[model samples]
Target chain A: MSHAEKKARTTTDEYELIYWPRLPGRGEPIRLLLEEAGASYTDTAHEKDGIQKVVGALKPDFDPGKDNLPGLAPPMLRCGDLFISQSPNIMLFLGERLKLIPGDVEINKYRVNQLVLTMLDLQNEVHDSHHPIAVSLYYDDQKAEAKRKAEDVRNARIPKFFNYFELVIGKSEGPYLLSEFSYADLVLWHLVDGCLYAFPKAMNRQFEKSPKVKELYDTVAKRARIAAYLSSERRQKYDNGIYRYYEELDE
Target chain B: MSHAEKKARTTTDEYELIYWPRLPGRGEPIRLLLEEAGASYTDTAHEKDGIQKVVGALKPDFDPGKDNLPGLAPPMLRCGDLFISQSPNIMLFLGERLKLIPGDVEINKYRVNQLVLTMLDLQNEVHDSHHPIAVSLYYDDQKAEAKRKAEDVRNARIPKFFNYFELVIGKSEGPYLLSEFSYADLVLWHLVDGCLYAFPKAMNRQFEKSPKVKELYDTVAKRARIAAYLSSERRQKYDNGIYRYYEELDE
Candidate 1:
């Protein structure tokens, strides 16, 4: 195959995503990218006995020969021989390859990365609001603290981030974070989708102040591939993962 | 200038770092990279009326013409005409330009970025441990939550991350994260150093298990430019920032 042919054919059947099964968790963003691009990938989270793939990957003492540097958590992706973890790192790699980001200008990739990183940061904040005391402990163990923390995230942080999203989307031509579709848009869409599921009342109140963000969220939902992926059996529900619904915690 | 000259001359005096004044905080990592690269950068935090520059940048409403997309927070950087925020993005740009990472291979850059992002995640966790309830609230207001959160961080999270750092550094040939000097080493070194300052007793106890991490921290501290930079007036204290030494919160 020619070099151009190789560049164009970034997606392959060999791509394997390693993450916990049963909940979409952080892996959904990666899955969204694959689905949108029609890229073939094996999501270990979905397979029978798949969680063993994730747990085994987390086993300490990585062999020096595997080029497997120790990563703290999963959502690791393996394309051919290269294995890497970290959701943003995996997104950057696949975004470039899957045509999920704009091409030609080098700096533009960093621009998309900037927005994605911000959204991911907010995602972590949302997670922490529920697990305020410790991830090692259950939500019941820190329910009181979670109540206070969730109030702050729902009242202040979400609006702050959504406004920034609205401000950024306005700078571009279309509904996407950039003028064209980028992986940042996919991540943003997932964040809003998850937020809506987790805190529907708060997000609905926030949508009033961030109509553009709400519009973009709806726009991404209607995308043919994404719509199919959302309704498919493969898409997991929000459970004990990052975005959880506890009636007491929600406004 | 020729292409070779331009490639080698990555350190332009024109690079301006925009951040808060009087505290090393998040901006210090960026400063560490610039100092190690011997890249002359104007830190907006230190100049006369410099805080104004950072404050002005934060004021809402981004201009489409400026290519200034809305960033949630700074350490915004300006190099030539390209203005960007988010510490990791700036580091990646400079890491490539200044040869901070091993060159000629594209995938290697992603590897270094992976480590840097993890360290930054720890940095945020350290910050959250202090202001557990909300970033908007004062430490005193969240003192109760902070104590519980800080204990979990000091005892569980820090060791988990430090061990991972040790594991990754062991994969390489030498003291640096990837054989030779890379930005990942600078980030890891700063993280360990900051933890030592913030949670001296805890870090000292943890260091016994993470001897390699301790060694790498010492190695980075002694690098000529870093050593010089640390002693210089440019290096700020860790007061009212991410890594704070609260005696009650420590041990």
Candidate 2:
């Protein structure tokens, strides 16, 4: 077979996402993308102790000697023979594949990649809010330290991240960072919403300095697809993961 | 001018980098890429506090608002009129540009992006070890919490992460992943090395079950360019930042 023919034969699944079913968590952005692009996908969430079963199936399949798919973590995506893990990686792969990003190499790559990193920063902040001292410790065990950390995050880091995004939105001079609604804009909106839900007092306090960010969040929140997704059975709240409700950690 | 003609006529710098010079932090990957690719261009590290004058004179013409460059953070890059930021973004961008990644669409994009995400995860773990309680809090202030968090990271998270990477590498069956050296392998090696340096007992205990990971780190350590870079003044050590050295933290 010709090389071109071989290349032509390689096709990928529209999307297959495996994540914790309970909360929006890190899987939320990918969910938003799939919804916005009207892409078809299978969203599977595991039951309690089902994590072991999921890992077991994945473990044997990814064995280099057997499966030929090399990967590090989940949420994993199996596109044709291409097996991929890592949430942001899944987002980028999907974004590029769906043409949800811009055509221009420079601005498009920059904006998409930057937004992915921003999401990483946001994830770190969100996770730390609960597991401030250690992930192994229960929230109740770490509540005191979490409270202290939350106070600092509310006053300082939250505003810093918000201001950064607002600066980007202002620079673009529109609802989107790249002058059009791409997957990133949707993801950022989801992140803002999650943060707000998790830290209402902090969100209100920090977002005051950046009205554009608030405006963008509001606009994206009301998008037909996002609104629909939020109201659908697919959407779950912060109680499961990502952002959890903790009173002392808030105001 | 024709698009090709315009491209030929425009002699923009091949690559441009924006980063904080005082610390290596996240920009090391980009620096390594440039050194590996033998690419040349500008390295902009905005002056912090007292260092403004030194940096200002270095790029007297750079105006963030008006210039062709628009960067919200340091460790950004510019090629022609295009700008890119975020450490992993820069790594993936350089990976494609330098042909450090495979040509196969899925393999190239998925692997490199996954590798970047893994690096980000490692970075988060490192950072949390220090500022586990509060990002805004100084290392000195969070010393107690830092010690506790570091123990959790060393005892639990580090091993899990190491084991995952070992599994991936084992599947690769390689001196390098994907049967070739890619940016991901290089960054992964760096993460392992940094963790070991920061938490010797933890890494030693964790890495015992993962010979492939240890082998990969040793191989990357021998790379002449990286060795030279490490020996040079450019290689910065972890202190108060991510992957900090806290004696009490280590077992």
User: Model 2, residue A199: displacement in angstroms?
Assistant: 1.3
lDDT of model 2 at position B145: 80
> Model 1, range A17-121, lDDT digits (tens) per residue?
989998999899999988877788899887898988788877775442455466688988888767888899899888887878775448788888889999998
* Candidate number of the best TM-score: 1
lDDT of 2 by residue, A146-204 (tens): 88778777777777777777777776786777676777788788778878888888788
DockQ per candidate? 0.71, 0.45
Give one clash count per candidate, in the order shown: 0, 3
Model 2 ranges off by over 4 Å: A1-13, A46-53, A57-71, A103-107, B1-13, B41-72, B103-106, B237-239
Q: lDDT of all predictions, in order shown?
A: 0.84, 0.69
Candidate 1 achieves a global lDDT of 0.84
Candidate 2 TM-score, true structure as reference: 0.86
**TM-scores of all predicted structures:** 0.95, 0.86
True contacts kept of each: 0.72, 0.70
lDDT of 1 by residue, B87-197 (tens): 898888888877787744487787888899999988988998889899999999899999999999998999899888877777775587776677899998889988988
